[model samples]
Target: MFSKEKIILAYTVEKCKKCNLERKRKYQEGDLLFAETSKCDSCDGIAVIEKIFGETIEK
Candidate 1:
């Protein structure tokens, strides 16, 4: 579980993007980016700002 301070990307369904997602994206408070909910993995992939790219970053 990541804290709000750790939030990097917020994932939501395409439709949700029209509302909640857009609101957060507009803020861009940090490394925030919005991805489709279906694409979400951990934490529903919501509010996940830190990308643990040690060995997970595979092109």
Candidate 2:
């Protein structure tokens, strides 16, 4: 039998500046770049995608 592996991407949520609220954002494997900056929609806060890593899962 052969096993299949899948790559899982993860991210950390950031707080909004104006409201200090945290929102759940979708994280795609290639959507974000390492050490890239983003924005918070709720409060328009300055956010960044500091860390990104991949995990292998057996399927």
Best-performing candidate as measured by lDDT? 2
TM-score of each: 0.14, 0.41
- Model 2: CA > 4 A from native: 1-36
Whole-model lDDT, model 2: 0.56
Off by over 4 Å in 1: 1-15, 18-32, 39-59
The TM-score leader among the candidates is: 2
Candidate 1 has what TM-score? 0.14
Query: Could you tell me how far off, in angstroms, the CA of residue 47 lies in candidate 1 after the best superposition?
Result: 12
Per-residue lDDT of model 1, residues 1-59, tens digit only? 75343334432222232223322222232332233323233224333332211212222
lDDT of 2 by residue, 28-51 (tens): 555454333567776677665544
Give the backbone clash total of model 2.
0
User: Lowest-lDDT window of 10 residues in candidate 1?
Assistant: 50-59
